[model samples]
Target: MIRMPAEWETHAATWVAWPHNRMDWPGKFAAIPFVFAEIIRHLGRRERVEILVRDAAMEARARGVLDRAGALSANVRFHALPTDRIWLRDSGCCFVRDGDALGAVQWRFNAWAKYDNFQQDAEVAGFMARAAGARGRRAGMVLEGGSIDVNGRGTLLTTEECLLSKVQERNPGLGREGYEKAFAEHLGIRKVIWLGDGIRGDDTHGHVDDLSRFVGERTVVTVVEPRRDDPNHAPLAENLRRLRAATDQDGRPLEVVELPLPGPLTYRGIRLPASYGNFYIANGLVLVPVFNDPNDRVALDLLASLFPDREIVGIYSGDFIWGFGAMHCMTQQQPALAVGE
Candidate 1:
């Protein structure tokens, strides 16, 4: 059994898959790698960054871009492995800690609701875990890294839309109770807090990172769209209300932090799901996705307050969000040390 660790802890490295597929990006594929490279720059400063490439040729191309952008650091390394896409948040290993040792739970990746072709991406977990020198355990159940959040205690935050759906066929025999047991054994999670739905434009079928996130133990930062006419207004409002009413593993009420959603961001006739809730926490920094909107400052200020010790930096995600996700949806973390280490 493998149990995922909390995001606030130390990390040995971060995992990212280089963006290469133009089909996923349509005509804007050229700009996406630069965005990824910028993120790599931020991550590489603090800890090691392991980037997955299709082959040596792709690695050379990515390296060239990184060099041009001045984004490559000594901590950044490349792995020439084939992958379906660049979103590591969906296909990477979920790192956990067992006593003092690190273990990984390799969940079945199906390209989120089995939307895209993910034959190679599904095998990323095992490859990433082995490269990171962690024990990998393959779980028959399907899951995504962005779908679940841990408090470093025993509580997990997720949405029913992603995990409970029968359409994806990830969990055929696991009902809610069965899921609880599976999570308990594999992830060392004692309680599962299920939210009703995710944001509207999310194609991943309600990843919790887009709707709600655990900022701290017994505390969550949720996106809120106050306009009743807006599509996400009701669902996000309901999620906030649920967080306010929910209790943690200690039987205490959760402290809910309300974060405003950026106004609708569109590109090439497509409205992307851009929200401030999808921020990634790293070793010494919190990388947030900025939509080039006025609300970017507000979101940065709020997240900065959340993590005073760590630096809060926001990168323009207008081009990156075109793929329907942002920074948090593109990267995964590996813990540096376990709880007892």
Candidate 2:
């Protein structure tokens, strides 16, 4: 059993899949790689960034974007691989440690509640885990990185909307107890703190990253929308209530910090799930997604307060969210724990 660490202090590296699929972004696909490049640039300044690309051509294209953005750092590296989409946080390997040796728990990815074609994305875990110097162990259970949040101590945060939904068919026969045992054995988690639901307009069937994230050992920052008439209002409110009542593995109540949700940003007549709560904590900086909305400043200010030691920078996410996710959804972190340190 291997337990994944918290993102705040973990140190292995960051993984990202370069955007290449035209169908994913429709008429807007050309702009996504630049967004990914910006994110990579931010992460490269802190720790190693391992980018997955389909081939040499894609790698060159991605590199060109990074070079132009001046985001190319010595720590950035590329792995030429095949992928259907660019959401690495859902399909990338989830690294854990057994004392000093690194291992990976391969969760079954079903395209975020079986929403899209994911044949290549499903095989990405093994490919990425092996590349990162971890022994890949197939768990054969349906899970996504966005679906779970870890507190580094033994608690995990998740929602019923994503993990328990029948539409995903990832955990068909598995119940709560079964999932608990599986998580304990695979990811080394001792407690699973379940929330009720996720915000509306989330396409991944309620990834926890869109709703709540563990900012500290006993604290979580979640998105809150007070508009009662809005579709996301009630669900997020309920999640906030649950977070207030939930406790970690040590039986301590979580300190909940509320982040304001950006006013609905629509493109092509579709409401994109733009959120500041989807920020990714890296080695030296916190990469946050910033929509070109007024709340961008407020979200950045609040995140700066949460990550007092790290540099918090916001990338324009107005164009990125058209693909249905922001920064955290596009990358996964590999903890830097060595064997038996």
Clash counts per candidate, in order, are 1, 6
- lDDT tens readout by residue for model 2, 1-341: 46788888767788888888887788887788788877877788778988888899988888888999998888988888899898988887788876677888889887876566898999899988888888778988878888899998899998887767786657777888888888898888988989877776678878899889999999899999988888988888889888899888879999999999999888778877888889999987898998778999999998898889899999998778888898899888888865557
In candidate 1, the residue pairs with backbone N, CA or C atoms under 3 Å apart (3 or more residues apart, or in different chains) clash, namely 2-186
lDDT of each: 0.85, 0.85
Runs in model 1 deviating more than 4 A are 1-3, 167-169, 338-340
Report per-prediction Cα RMSD to one decimal: 1.5, 1.4
Please write out the lDDT profile of model 1 over residues 8-38, one tens digit for every residue. 7888988998888888778777899899888
In model 2, where do residues sit more than 4 Å from their true spots? 338-340
User: How many angstroms is residue 74 displaced in model 1 relative to the true structure, after the best TM-score fit?
Assistant: 1.3
Error of 1 at 250 (Å): 1.4
Cand. 1 Cα-lDDT: 0.85
